[model samples]
Target: MAEQKNRFPLKRREFVKIAVSFLPAAFLLPATARAMALVRSPVRVNRLRPPGAVPEEIFAGKCIRCGRCVEVCPYRSIELLDIRAGVFAGTPIIRAEEIPCYLCMKCTQVCPTGTLQKISQEKTRMGLAVVNRHLCYTWQSMTICRTCFDVCPFKEKAITLDQLRPVIMEEYCVGCGICSHACPVTAADGMKAVTIEPIYSWE
Candidate 1:
């Protein structure tokens, strides 16, 4: 009975310690929020731009918020940004999971503003596809899967198998989002084994 009484105080003390430890984090939360707000950081980490987009600098200045690109897209892959996008508001974006661009290149034709440039499917550079080896069946040697390779528009050119495992040839990848939407792993695990990476450019 005496020991049981003593145990209560120790548990109380540990609880107090944990509560005190959270004080620093609580204080830092406001500063972190402010930093992010100031930066106006893009919400999409792998935010794939519309097909045939020019360099970020040139595209930003040229895009006139015309919704023609959004209307012409058959797959509904392109979406215009809302007010929350800061200076990039009204720019078109493609979230690969929702709808991958079919590489039809129709969006460019209707653009009154030259934000989405006129480029061939073969020359378009939306982004790259990187395989998550940890989640990939081929790299884990658990099973042979080639969904990404099979769906690639530039199959032999962009993706090929080495030792019966998939390899993404970055140079040839158009970042069209086909492999990202077609990935079999995302269906089973809710995590994409192959996903699109937005094209990054220098300022």
Candidate 2:
């Protein structure tokens, strides 16, 4: 009985030491998991959700992945993400460069869940369009390229000519990605001079 009692204290000490070693990792585990989730998530630049999408944080949980948005899109702009998208798999995504969202507002109307709230095309803020002056022919004085300006749905409101170079107006730009697809100048990396960025993705 005495021998067992003596060993109990030693076992307790070993357990305490082991638990202490894991304490720091326990504190860091949640943060590490969150960081890993962000890395593996489908959210990224140029990839837009259907118009009137809710914030990305709640999007996965709220979205039932029924593909209603994909089916209702008359322009065939929305596509379901494959299994490689991690938790966001089966969720609808718009690859503007390939098939830009036409802002027909059809997808928003078909969503069974509020993940894609119905809103006006003019009010939908899917993302923002950024102009890379270095790659832009008009900005760099290479050629008079007004393709982006001409293709923009908002035209004079979203994009305007400044000294004949296309300038993006953030407040009015809807990030529809039409300009990105229409831009004639393609960088060596295959990116357009004007690209839509997921500026409003997180929130």
Candidate 3:
């Protein structure tokens, strides 16, 4: 009993020494640590869909973050953007380089979750691509840059040229973002020809 009691003090001393040794590590680690930290990152989803369009609910609910949609996209329109709003980490964002979604529905086909469903290209209305008239060179009464109109895969309906400039028919426009990526002024002026917005039900 006495020996055990004596060993208790020694054990306590050993534990204290070990703990003290780790103190410097704790302090040093902070100094040497990089910017990486487990922060509560935000997830942004359904930004590509119309306001009420909830994609999270549409896809099988549990969408494993895989690059399937990005890989299958022929137009290279689908990309993974950093999570900024909800619970998701990195999710897909469409960038239209004047080649908006022709309603290919390929992304949906690749998506494991009903998140991206295999809907007909004709029926798919992901979102509407809005154009900023002021930033558009043609729309702003500048040189005729019909790049967006020319590149759009949608036949006669998606994008229409008026007065030598392009106008997006909200009903026909899908938030593909091809025009945004294809815009020549994007790099210099930081303006995109197309942007995604929630689907609106006027009725």
Candidate 4:
């Protein structure tokens, strides 16, 4: 009788262990497959766009997903979301928090299509990076350094000199990434750079 009782418990435990192991796969597989399908299918028809002022027409019409943009991005902000859907299955997606774009224009420079567009620093408008006067060392009555303005390719334009201090012109800011890359304050307090959000959707 004792042997049988112990055997019963052992059988029950074995069943429970088996059930527990397979349960997770049952739930996870469907979700993982769906996500994979969404990324792999060409004509995504549900891809979410990046946030901020990116050119929708250019992104939709030109991006070829050659990985050049992601490869050249110094900050590694651009990444391939998936290889399932959208214009380019393995195209780059901007991950602002992990590695925000610095507007270096290297991606645009390497893009084979006009997706990234080719504009001189004088006419570059890849979104502007504005200084939070409250956060800026120069505006906060601290040291004086215009690293962002000096590094900007736009000559006396995109980021201009106001009394030898950097000032952003909203109309001219195109969210490129140059100022973000050159900002000396980025490593200190996550300041000096932020990408405009909610512009695109690759659902």
The top-ranked prediction according to TM-score is 2
Question: What is the per-residue lDDT of model 4 for residues 56-120, given as tens digits with 9 covering 90 to 100?
Answer: 54464566657777777787777775644534456566533344555566776777776666655
The C-alpha local distance difference test score for the whole of candidate 4 amounts to 0.56
lDDT of 2 at 192: 86
On lDDT, who's better, 1 or 3? 1
| TM-score list, all predictions | 0.76, 0.81, 0.59, 0.49
| Per-residue lDDT of candidate 2, residues 1-203 (tens digit) | 89998768567788899999999999899978876764465756678898899998889889999998888889899999887677888999998888898899988888999899988878888889999999999999988989989989999999999989999999998889999889888899888898998888887
In what order do the candidates fall by TM-score, top score first? 2, 1, 3, 4
lDDT of 4 at 173: 59
**Candidate 1 or 3, higher TM-score?**
1
User: Each prediction's Cα lDDT score?
Assistant: 0.79, 0.88, 0.57, 0.56
Model 1 per-residue lDDT tens digits across residues 1-203: 89997777667788889999999989999978766664453424347778778777666578888789999998888888887666677888888866888889999898887777799998888888888888888888989989888988899889899998888898898888788788777636465888777644322
* Model 3 regions more than 4 Å off: 1-60, 74-76, 81-86, 96-104, 187-189, 198-203
Question: If both were scored by lDDT, which would come out higher, candidate 1 or candidate 2?
Answer: 2
